[model samples]
Target: MSNKAGSFLRNLGQFSPLDPRSRTLRLYPLKFSRPKISHSNWNLRNLLLNDFDNGIRTSIRYLFQDPFILKSGDGSLQRKGISIATFLRVDRHHCPRRLSFDSKHSLVSAPPFDDGLKKVNVNPEVSGGAGLSKEINPPPISYRKLSQECNSLSDVLDIFSNAPTFPSSTYFSAMWTIAKRMSEDQKRFEKQLMFGHPAFSQLCDQMMKETRIMYYDHLLFSLYAMVKLGVPQNTLVVQTSLRMVQERINECDERCLSVLSILLKEMDKCKNVDVLKAGLRILVHQQVWKIESIFTLQTVMKCIGKDTSIALKKKLEMKALKELDRFSLLNSQHMFEALAAMNHRSVALLNECSKKVIDNIHGCPFKILVSILRSCRELQYYNLDLCKGIADYVATTFDIWNLKQILLFLISFENLRFRPTDLMDLLMKKVVEKPESLNMRNIIFILYVYSSLNHTDKCQHKEFLEVMSSALTGCLHHISSENLLKAMYSFCIMNYFPLAPLNQLLQKEIINKLLTSGDTEKNVSRLHILDVCLKLDKVAYQHAIDLQLPLPPPSLSLSHSKVAQVLSSLLGGEEYFARNVQLPNNYHIDFEIRMDANRSQAFLFSEADVTSTNLRRVAVLCVPRSLYCLDLSHPRGFLAMKMRHLDVMGFHVILVKNWLMEKLKMEDASMFLKTKIYSVEAHPTTDVNLHNTY
Candidate 1:
């Protein structure tokens, strides 16, 4: 039956394949030149090909791997050996050299590098060797074997360019396998090879021209490989396959539909595929838990946006929520990172993610930890346990932390409105120790932490500011307008006026951008603070962009009301204080009272419709607890500057803290007010001579 090449082809129908419907054919023994042996001792029974990815999906593994031998009567092919089903490996451009593995037949043209392939002994008991069959079957190339043998990009390209069939997913597999074994430099070249080289173009061209794909899986198999490699969705091969799938949309199941959506998103063509996305989300929701790759789920999450219907987004989120347990620690970090990057917030999901991060804190990578913190901050999540764990890990391991990492950690904690005390201390120490590592942006954050988080100032802070000031001044020209204002004003908050950096910021273009660019209202508030600081510090630089901040009409805060009550008891009536008085410069005062600098007597600025020229004026700026640094009586940069300006304007600035007034008993409150008001006379509001106690 194996004697003639034509006979072998003819007899293939006679042997019943294990799968009655198996389409895979065996072509291993087309070595059918009749060797004139009416063969004595050789029995060619039980010879077969091996199975592949599916049941009875056999193919050839020899020539590139171990070749199984089958023998009977006198010898043995490993009895349990599995042989792959071999077929013709066709290249329309070049004919492949042929090989035969029939009993007593040796390889025709094996490479010299191989020690040798085992020679088959079909008839050990038979005295003489069989003559070679001239009709050897062409060998099928194994992608796995090609990947194993190649050691360089050039070799891969050579294999690709010479004697190859294009539009094969197996080729994608081969490329990646080679890429994995390549050095980092070669791996980078692998990407450039696909992007800039002609070999890739030919492959894509063949994909476009090839009309032989019989199954959707073949096309999607290529898509899967591309996604894993981060291949650009704009690549010709990917675009062609996308069109193919869109054309075959009705035939595609959910899995293929989701894959198409992901590729379209990568192409930034989600709008073009909006209809597909609607259905895609539905299919993914139906099968969310079935998915095991969190990365796949993350990519799926990124695909939905404002264009997607809210109902569909909710469904997808809910399904993913139920299946979040499917994620590992690292994967959970990635999942929430995508959620945060997309600016999609889910309370339950983030809560779950916070727990995941904290639970896995000991093993977390710094990068993943940063991502987790971003999710929390961006989504306004507040998990104290997670915050503490992250802070502890970071503080203990901060030798490895870079400037960017420290900045992100600060921003996250600052946003969460939770002070990571140890982390903050460590950062302060780092700044004092290595001020050179800081840039303009980091200097702003450092100033902010000192200005906002530090209650009682440390000597290191002054040293930090001294070192930071020079670095900040050097880079002032390169900073953005918003950043310029923030850096200067943050220093103002810390009570160190950088006259040089401030002068640099007062340019016409910078001031214009500060007043006109993004978030102008917030920008102007910063400008107002800087203006107050500059004037109070008596540093002259003339780029005053006039701004009138709207003032609230006469009203009293609860703290002001509490202060009003205390003042009325001391000065004989509620009429002794006027509330919500706007200063000539338009800064609002919480209350105004007329008292001698001694505070032995107090009266209203306009009691009984008469001005009090005899009494020194007091501007009581009632501030919320948020206006102060956490757990401290220290006011933040803006509030501090406003007070200095008021002091310059001839009103002794008396801080009326809402936190203090709101809690004080009447007896103690009156005394507190008296002490606060009278202390202004003992030690006046020091503007020019004030040192930064931050």
Candidate 2:
């Protein structure tokens, strides 16, 4: 070795074991400010002091300086570095460990050195640094060498094939990976890789190729992948996969089975009914074992009767009856299959099934049945025989949810094209027949439809409102707290639809319902009521704004006409709707209806009241002390909504209501006389007043 290198090695032997941290502390500032004491100079001093033991340092320097390394033919520095790294096996920390070699392996000789040169002595310093080591133990070895290595992919495959199954995690991961990989392959490759593989088939021999769990897991993966790949929803492979999964139900977990059940039902929700029908056919054949654990069979029975009763009483015009009959035939067979699937060999056992099974049968059968009902022309004709057939079927059955379904179908006939008179005729009959027997949900649904269509005609059967109200009150008692809230909210919203005219007794009943319902958690009930109040207030305010009526000031009174005070005691009124009101901003409302330009300085009624200008877009600004001036320039009406809610910021229903009331006052004779407004025709702008006309 050269003298410089030899000396460096000797110094390293003496200094390498000293703590690096201590060396760094002692050497840093002196090395930093003094050029002579820098790294190269430091190395030179060590080389001069210990010239005999630095073979590795000298060799690395030579490697970097070599002509081939400096000017590589391929010009790849990273390749060279990687080759060095592989050769060295240095960890990322740059600390080197023992090389893989055996004592018997032949060693290549080092390049010949000049005759005068002498090898550095490293043994003495190494022995000295170790204090009194008798001998160093051999370096640690890798554990992987203990196993026999497979030389080829064929051998690896054979190992798996001979085994009873791949490990569970490995098998599942393989299926997941293969399914994903299949999508990107050419069509031919996919067929060969997936369909031709015996491991993917359903029979026991194919299943024995892997565990049953693995096979089923792969089946799920395949089906899910098909959806993600945008295969035609009705493709044979997709359908086959679905059927295969359903066939393997006993092997699937309860949650998975539940999901499948839900999907089978929701298939109907797809726009293509044919897909739904096909899916239902496949699912109905499966024995959903978990059904007994999750559903209450008696509940379903109660619902079926209720729905049938509703469908029977629903008055259908000939046209609607015809439409209903048309819509039914296309769907009946599938509906019947779904309903029958819910029934098992034992009646007593039917009382409980997974909700998944019950709900599917409950909600879907009606849709299918509705389709069938539409196809029966005699029924569509609204013949007395058909109506009697429907009513008797409903009153006798026990399936309330199904009954709800049938009622909804009849209510469907309330569409504008169906004659309202015919619907009313059938509805009156039903209302009189089973007032007490109907469940609350069904009753509320009927009321919802009735209220929606009531309009001016509500005056004729005003007493029906009392019955409907009583029916809802009775229904509420039997339902869960969540349903009670939903039902009550639905009833209140339906009330807003111009049903029977508002009356004192009906108002009192509404208040009573609200109070009775509030007996649970006051805050919970209050929040629920507040939510309704905000919606109502928004609807009222929007209506007024759309009509351009002066709005009543935002206050507790308009929103909670029956229970604003009660709500405040629980929810702190304004704080509630101000933040949580669900009204859309773009909704149109009547905010500036009654302004008489001739009498008040606030608005100019003549040229400004053009049809093209939507005046409600204006923002109302409160100056100070109840002085409010609306900015007429803002875009009028509800702002378009980002989310669903009934309340809007900076707007309230009471103000809009008050504005409408004030607008009506302009029509009063006493106001005109007291204002001394005479010869209105003589006055162009001031003569026409809001309260003066409807």
Scored by lDDT, the top model is 1
Cα lDDT tens digits for candidate 1, 609-651: 3344556787777777666644344465457667777878778
Question: Where in model 2 is the C-alpha error above 4 Å?
Answer: 1-203, 206-405, 410-421, 452-460, 493-694
Per-residue C-alpha lDDT of model 2 across residues 1-694, encoded as one tens digit per residue: 8666555555333221111222211111111011221233433235324422332223322121111122233633321221121011111111111111111111111113322212222322242223222322222211122112333222223333443222222322333334443445543354344433443322212221122223344455434544443433443334434444543434444334334444344332322333333332223223222123222211222122222332221211121223333333322233223233332122112122211222334333445434333433212222233333343444344335444555655564432112234445445555655677677666656654554443224544555555666665554445554444444444444343222222211244443554456554442433343343334444432221111112222422123222223222322332221222223322323222212323222233333443433332122111121111121111111111210122233322222223333333333423332223223443456545532441
TM-score for each predicted model, relative to the true structure: 0.60, 0.25
lDDT of 1 at 298: 74
lDDT of each: 0.58, 0.32
